[model samples]
Target: MSDTRPWIYSTDHDDPDPRTPEPGHVYVQLVGGPLDGQLLDITGYTPEERAHGALLMSNHGLHGPGGRSDYEPRPGAPDRWAGAADTT
Candidate 1:
């Protein structure tokens, strides 16, 4: 199967939010992707900020302290490209 795993993003250094987050809930880049690969761009940040490579909103619902089904992003919407900002 294609790799469709969920990538977890968090702003907390130690303890992240306990509640599960819906897909598309963006967290600024706390880290960067590989140097040679196409880094997923995220809005709400600068090029340097995007260079950091923010987390993609996971399709797999919530996780850990935040159980699945706890978060829900704008379902049935097209995936937003990186560098896009939250309009709402």
Candidate 2:
């Protein structure tokens, strides 16, 4: 099977967001649950809002969505986040 992840074009190529010194966006690595290792781009959320984390719905009305995936800021690792899952 082939990898169908959506974060393939995230940080590698020339990023279009020019807000450098403090870009309007931030990438958090989701480290658990079904969305593990996924890079979530919280561009519109404030710093405090990002810290509170989010309960993202994978595929609400569709099949194989795996329900809501909860993620919070990983302690001591600001760049990474996670849901209720073992291992990092």
lDDT of each: 0.31, 0.63
User: Candidate 1, residue 1: CA error in Å?
Assistant: 22
Candidate 1 structure quality by residue, lDDT tens digits, 4-67: 4333343244645323344664432212221111222244666564433333443232332322
Model 1 ranges with Cα > 4 A deviation: 1-44, 61-88
lDDT of 2 by residue, 1-88 (tens): 9545545213545666422324565777777666676677777778898888877655422234555666799889977887753221
Clashes of 1: 4
Best by lDDT: 2
Please report how far candidate 1 places residue 57 from its true position, in Å: 3.0
Each candidate's number of clashing pairs is: 4, 0
* TM-score, prediction 1: 0.20
Clashing pairs in 1: 24-57, 41-82, 42-83, 43-83
Stretches > 4 Å off in candidate 2? 1-24, 59-66, 85-88
